[model samples]
Target: MSERRSISSGSVFEERIGYARAVVDGDRVHVSGTTGYDYATMSIADDVVAQCAQAIRNVEAALAEAGCTLADVVRVRYLLPDRADFEPCWPTLRAAFGEVRPAATMLVCGLAEPAMRFEIEVDARRR
Candidate 1:
């Protein structure tokens, strides 16, 4: 049987957020909802596009930690604070996943942090 492993960069959430950044089980890796915040600095980027890019980067970093890459991603979830923001950032997302063409869903809703404009999460598998 395969074992489950938690993916963390030694960061901790002060609140009672019952979640890990990512989890690896066998050949599969699942990343939790990731925001635009720079985990190193814990600050959200100012630009929406930049934030979107950073969010994806963070996802990729998590995947890499699990011995995976963006190409291994099979699904993604994008959460935007507004539809307008989603429209403008659609192209960026498409370009990022152009080759992978992972199944994706975009949503608009309030995020945990006000400064966060976009959040992304992904699921990846490796053989």
Candidate 2:
């Protein structure tokens, strides 16, 4: 049987909210919806594009901890509060995922905080 383990990004939310940043079970990794906040400083950008880039980096960190990378991602979810903000983030998003080309979904909804403009979550299988 494959062991299951949780990964953390050293974010207070993971501890305060009681959830891991990602979980690795068997050959699969499930990463939680991660926001744009820089875990080191808990800082977020005002521009959605910048936020999108940071969010992707945060997701990358979690995936790396699980012995995976964006190339291993089979699914991805993008969450945004404003639909318009998503377009401006396309360039940054494309730069990160253009090659990986994982199945993706984008949803317009309220996030945990008003300052959070973008969040991302992913599922990956080790190759």
Candidate 3:
């Protein structure tokens, strides 16, 4: 059997928070919960729709590094701070995953950061 490998993007959380940004085990990639905070500025956007887009962008970045793409995604988990934010952002989410049609779940919950409105995590398999 091939050895499993862990991958990270030098996110400080990998050290301080006891979790990797992404883990690659053979042909599978498991991405951790990612928020809309721009890594460059370390700031979360104020708008929920924009935040949803940014979160998906972050997921794509991790998937790319794992040799996968949105089309390769098999599952998605969305954590929303408020249920009210879901409808407004559904269109964006639907458009992004329309082709992939990955299994998904969205839940209402508080996030790790106060300013963050949404957190997205994904699982992808290489073709």
Candidate 4:
């Protein structure tokens, strides 16, 4: 049997909300929906595209901590408060997953905060 590990990005919400950024069990990693907030500054961009970029970076960091990368992602989920925002993020999202082309889904829905225009979640298998 393999061990389980939890990775944290030091986001206050992780503690306040009672969740880790990602959890690793054996060869798989499950990363929670990450927002655009730069954990270092605790600030998020107003532009949806910019937010999408940062959100990808955030997810990458969590993946890295688990010895994985975007290339190892097996699944990805993009959540947006406005469906219109999804198209604008495609380029950035494609830049990260174009070759890897993980299974993906984008949903139109509300987020934790009104300022949060985009959120992303990923599942990865160690490769």
- Among the numbered candidates, top TM-score falls to 4
Clashing pairs counted in every model: 0, 0, 0, 0
Candidate 3: which pairs clash?
A: none
Better candidate number, 2 or 4, judged by TM-score: 4
TM-score order of candidates, top first: 4, 2, 3, 1
lDDT (10s digit) by residue, model 1, range 19-121? 7788999988999988877778877778899899888888888888999999999999999888788877878887889899999998889998788899898
Task: Return the clash pairs for model 4, or none.
Answer: none
Residue pair clashes in candidate 2: none
Superposed model 3: Cα runs more than 4 Å off: none
Off by over 4 Å in 2: none
TM-score of each: 0.91, 0.97, 0.92, 0.98
How well does model 3 score by local distance difference test? 0.86
Q: What is the lDDT of candidate 1?
A: 0.85
Clashing residue pairs for model 1: none
- Supply the global lDDT for candidate 4: 0.95
The TM-score between candidate 1 and the true structure equals 0.91
Model 1 stretches with alpha carbons more than 4 Å out? 14-16
lDDT of 4 by residue, 48-77 (tens): 999999999999999999999999999999
